[model samples]
Target: MDGTALLRWGRVCLDDLADRREEINALNVFPIADADTGTNLLATMRAAMAEVRTRGPVDALTTHDVAAAMARGATLGARGNSGIILSQVLRGIADAVRGGPLTALTLRDALRRASVLVRDALSEPIEGTILTVLDCAAASAASCRDASLADVALAAADGAAKALGDTPSQLGVLRAAGVVDAGARGLVVLLDALVSITLGEIPARPEYSPRASVAAQPVEDSGETGSAEPRFEVMYLLADTDADRIARLRARLAELGDSVVVVGDGEGRWSAHVHCADAGAAVEAGLAAGELSGIRIESFAQHGREMASGHPLAPVDSAGKLDGPADRGVLAVACGDDAAELFEEAGAVVLAGDDGVTAAELLAAIRAMPNREVLVLPNGALPAHDLVAVGVAARDAHRDVLLLPSASMVQGLAALAVHDRGRIAVDDAFAMSEAAATTRWGSLRAAGERALTMVGTCEVGDGLGLVGHEVVVIDHDVRAAGRTLLDRMLAFGGELVTLLMGAAARDGLAGELVAHIGESFPGVEVTVYSGGQHGDLVQIGVE
Candidate 1:
């Protein structure tokens, strides 16, 4: 198939699957009720689609490029167990078809290899799961002697469907619960959707009607209307860079506008999304030392009109216009709902962006609010660069803005806890930034690989304990790590210790950790609370 044709097929399949996500989500029977199989799959595919659309169509497009893009999307957008598995499946296919224009035989071999690769990637393969269904489907496809692409996909879908039906019977848990294997069923639906799309059957759009009544409409041509038409939406990736340079870049972007979203690591490679008028300037600014890829520019004026007419874009801007008292307004950029809620509770308006937010997006969010003056809190180290972009956008828009360099969530929370609401915006920003920086922050995260860290030699999947910017401990037991972290905090004469337990660690573990701290340090007060959950893990923040 041609490159454009392949992309079209992928997109159509994605749209079909997206339409039936709720049905796919309902199929979960095992691994408890908090299942996000369908949602995860959709998100993973959407990420790939975004990249595909950004790259557009090229005459000499190689399968390698397509596969590489898909793999990149999967890595970044992977969420749950099912999502990770699906990503691996795509990665395998990409690996198999690494050379060029795909023929029926190459495609079949890719599917066959992908099935095996997916199974190998999983630690334990269980029957009546997505893995089994995919394995059977691939076997069916491989056995066909003269199968075309359509024929292979149809056979694969058929095998998957049968496997899904038998899942309840194969697994005792599923039989007892009288429900099908959720993950397996979701995978079947995805494959079936792909087949249907290939056969020219398009699904209907899913309804998103909520139970709550709609609020009164704002005046159409009021002062708020112009703000809705943000001039531009900009996105780019930075090459090789450091934190100090990134910080300066952020300060520059901050002057642009309110809806800024700069996301990337400090190691020279970064991506940013911003909504502003001067997108050219924004792209030009990031061109220093790094080659920009995947640049996207959208006109919000046309976008807002489309939305008003019932064609809403993706839920990118959840934070509505900023208005009301300017004593302290928050400007935060984060991706997950749990993270956003954490900042919201700490008296800041949360803007959703993973890693970092662009200056244009930040400026747009700020300008959307009616407030004339505001304080920005970039909670991640990498996002600190966006503060500069926000400032630049703000100055161009003639808005007063103050940036509080709250480099991490811990610092942002601390600063919010002691914010002086009565002070001027500049004074409040500086004070909160300074206060947030002083609080000691540590995190317990799983090691991605077995390597020698600053703390010591650590194995993959081990719990890595970090104190501020330093590595302190690496172990397998989360509880033990928490205890060690608490002891270290107390050793620093820490009077008030707050343990923000992640969902995984929220099963009365925090109380136990607190008790351990209490026994170790008699005078200090320790508080335990939940930090919510995101993806497959929990986060416990200690202050």
Candidate 2:
């Protein structure tokens, strides 16, 4: 096996998959529920990259070692149903290649084994998932009985592509959702990247140029003299004793700049780049991490002016301005329009969609707000990391930003309902949001193969009943599920119950759920309303 080729292929796979993460996430029919397949795959691939980095060199890595590393990475990092399936596929490949030299023949056999393992693992294999793609790839490879490694890989890629293209036709849910098989598509991209890398067709990196000269153009001789101080751009690596402490240092860097990129590992290693007027402050922040290395600073004012004269320079700072109101603003990261409007009506300036909005965006949003303090609501489980990232960004920017950990749509709605604009302090809003959030339960329908979770044994088509983080029930009948879920909600001695049914559930099941809730939870006033979206789903809240 060519070790260098292996690593190159892995990198290619990750880059290709990363490029389409948003598309994969959007393919989710139940957008409000779970759509983390892409994110989970990216995270899993990132873990694999870390393991690859630890390997002594391309030459030192045996085929077995590479396979083992990938399997371990996937096992530790995989998330959601799709992620687990992807991981299992990798595991199958690893097991098949465990005692092998990994030539074209071994690779072909491995692919076959991977397909079989995945199909067996799934209770009911769907036609538009990673499993389908892998199965097709294996069959294609097997068809070429006398092919080279490269030939087999190419065949596999082609087969995966064909499988991905057929996803819409194979799955009704995918067709209704207006997306090709997201998981299958992602897998095909990953395979294509690997094939490209194996064939040595890596793209070139652009040259880096300074940006300060272009940004520092002087105005015409108006009586006032402009400051001649050169704004500096700095890049450095910091090693901290503790990761949390580095977060505090990041908070300090936010006050100094326009472009700030602070990326740190949880294990005390950090890399940062910033374009700011005060280079010393940036350096000081790095010093807080204990020691610094590869420190480089250049004046950007001159570069900015040069760029203004039609000479383009590389951007100095990748981190754009924080997004929020200048005086009073709302920062929310959520999926679905209804969720966004809930926050908007609660006086929040909503950032629509999931991608492009990072921690820096949150900080920018908070800083842009007119009020000294800003409130942030992360309306989903996946965006929680981004919210934390924003918190760190806010702390670095020295902005008063409050993050309410609302894990579901219902909780987010509840939090918005109790938001008090008059309360300037975060503690006040935090208390109220927390209380309001507690009054509601978040329920969602499960997708993909059924599995026994910490919540319970959930099937793919079952309606999932969630009270907080625990999965209380999974049932086929919508009304029965709603009634059982409501009973669980009312057990807490709630006086009122509200059911917000999704657009899909409105025609058939919403009225039934309302009737059931009214009957089951005696003396508990039940209210049923449309979730105001198209979907055969319903949200039942017992207050």
Candidate 3:
């Protein structure tokens, strides 16, 4: 296949996985019942597709280039055990197509290489898991080497489906749970997506579900049939390491605990995962090997306890039940005193300062909070990687932290406006997230230097109006820029316009904008606040 075809395959895979993310998550009883297999897979695929899209235009890329990008992105973005294994599979396919087209023979070779690489990556490859399903697919692909690429993909998908169906018989955990292996089921979805792309039609597949006898059984505990599973799940990215050191790291992690997986991206970068009692030692072993980043250590014991109680939320204790009040806290990152006060008045624990809030500060703030469940609003100040790091660290410390994807301070306020302590944590989080997502946000800032933007050239002292990160309007007059921003934002249909005057905003700017909105877009309500935020002259949110 070509690069365009590969891109289509990635899109199809991502869409299919997105549709069945929660379903796949529900089948996660093996490894650990974190119920994030679907999330991990979706995240990994998204990272891959994102990288592919970044490689200039689709027409400019070759099959090898796209495959290599996929492998690299998957390696760097892989999460959990399943994501790591999936990375290896992508890497193998890339290797197979390095010097050839993705024909039936090369696809067969790709599957075979993937099986070997996956087995090697795992410290102890388990049956009835993704590994077994991959092996079955590879074998079937090998038998159809002389056929067309579509036929080979069909064989692979069929083999994976059969293996997934038999996973319960291979492992006691799945048998007890009366469900197919979650990771294997995810692989089948991927392979089916491949078949869809190759044949231009979706193949029929069995519904992935629990056996009839266990269909109604509640998941009280993780179906991990063992004396006692490891307490912690540690994962990290290791760089500047060699095969010898990776081997040693694997051996060391195996000594500490089980479920160890270390896979590389053909480059020096490697992703390591392990379930161990000594989380520190697991990380320390990687440190001895090379540099590390994205360090995440999760407690399975705490996770199990949480699962036993409920998936993500539970009823408050007797003292803080529906009749009584529960102390639900909101942690928001604000830029200045005005914004901080506004957040505090809205009942959020404000992390007020400059925009340079560190992960350490966020983690410390979360840990210091008395509430067990804390909602975090990063407010576009923190980077995505930093936000993820802080979330992992907070969870490691046993804090139930939910990071809302609020891109601006105004969006954070919009979310806070809908927060209700009376509702369950999950429902409250959903409501806040929905509010943040639906609000269209923009900002106005003075250009620091002359530069060419997506809109046009902007000189120093020019007012730049931006929606999200892209500058859409630039004008010499700040008020004109603000007017143009509102007009453009309102063109998309908004009933309410929320304006925050920044610390450096000119006097009467808010009133002028409100008047302009009233005259230009009648019936649109306007609310103004003194944000006192830095970097931007004004922040705007339309809902």
Candidate 4:
């Protein structure tokens, strides 16, 4: 394809996708089912088109220039998990064709390369997805190496269509929902668009819809209410790093979450994505690897209604707007339901969830706050960069945002204990900061895997106790580990000990600790709470 042809293909595909966006979205049930696959693909294509359009008239650009622009644009502007993968497909085509004319051999090479790129980008490629459809298309094109361009396009589209049809059988989620894969259907649309541009025909394919039996079923199980799956989708563009750093980032992201994809534009620039419960940690990983831009974190539970309505969620701004910004409001990032309740009951606004809060989310919350001076208790839920981003952005919008350096739930609670809206902003900030800094904290985790730690090597199921991020005690019995951890923390003398029990904490774990503290550490106060946080069995705070 020449520059003109490339631009035409992108335009055709964009229009086709726009026409089918709703249909594709309706079919999205797998992969957390925020139901925005169609929207994501359309956004990605628009980005590609925008890039090539900036290269002057089609006549001014070579085939290579257009291809490269499309790839770069797609990579930079890719949205969501599906969009990132689609960007990789574009990158593959660009890599294969360079500036050469699109012949049968080149078309075959493009499809093959696209498939490989897509797979390589994903941390864990699954079957019955866009990957499968793209793979089938590539394999089909490869088989028709000697065919004409039109024939190759036709073969690839046909293969994608066939694969789309069989997706329900290959994937249990699709089979249960009685619909073809949403992403696979999208790939077929792109391939059919290619066929249209090359062969002047768009293949007729069967429409896919959720069966009546499953149509009313929940598209996703976990959400704002709570879910078993990871809760947040985190994406960002990373630059100023290398392959080695990107490799390490990929491994780190996989450890933190799922549906991980990190793809480069063949240049140093890369698009990184992950679906994780801890949105903060995901972005932090990217930050550690290199400079990051366009950081976006989406909570799945918070996405569906807005997406379905095709609008940004209206911020809670009616009262704020009418009354103007009030004297003060506190925005506390809480990791669990109980923690959220505790924060809210303390007269502070709470950003509650383990899904991790992003700067964008923080800014929105800040804008929605009725208070003129907003105190943010990050509570370890946001990275330093995000804090800076939100602070700058909030100031730009004329809101005063004070991000307290609280690094744990315990610290956040400690800060909240001292927040005085009646005090001046600077004084309040200092008081809260002081309270947070003085609160010593630690946690207890049930080791999920055997690993060497500061304490010693711990086996799976063993209890590991951490004091300020360092594991200092490992015991076969979690209860014993908890006691030992408390002894170490209280050895220096503390007036009060707060124990926050996690979701999976034993029934009598807190009571046992409280009783033990009463007997062993006489005159010290003990307070316990059901934190409901994940990963940790219990979080400890000493004051």
Best by TM-score, which number? 4
Q: Which stretches of candidate 2 lie over 4 Å from their true place?
A: 1-327, 354-371, 381-385, 395-398, 455-457, 527-529, 532-536
Report the lDDT tens digits of candidate 3 across residue range 181-252. Answer: 888888999999999988988888877866667656655444343214578888988787899999999988
**Any idea what lDDT model 2 has?**
0.58
Estimate the TM-score for candidate 1. 0.42
TM-score of each: 0.42, 0.40, 0.58, 0.60
Runs of candidate 1 with Cα error greater than 4 angstroms are 56-60, 197-431, 434-543
Considering TM-score, which of the candidate structures 2 and 3 is the better prediction for this target? 3
Model 1: per-residue Cα lDDT over 232-325, one tens digit each: 6565556666656656665555465433434332123455544456765676567542545555455545445334446332222233222323
Q: lDDT, candidate 2, residue 491? A: 74
Q: Which ten residues in a row have the lowest lDDT in candidate 2?
A: 218-227
Ranking by lDDT: 3, 4, 1, 2
Sorting all predicted structures by TM-score, with the top scorer first, yields 4, 3, 1, 2
- RMSD per candidate (Å) reads 22.2, 21.9, 9.3, 17.7
Tell me the tens digit of each residue's lDDT in model 4 across 1-543.
Answer: 787897899999999999999999988877777789999999998998898888888898877788889889999999888888888788787887775867788888888898888888877777888889999999999998667899999999999999999988877777777888888888889989989999988889888778888887875432222224687888888888998999999989988888888999877789998887766567767866887788777877555533633543223344323223237789888888988898899888988758877656776787788765789888887667667646644642234678999989998989999986556666779999999999899999999999998768999999998998899999999899999999999999999888888989978888898999999999998888888888888989999
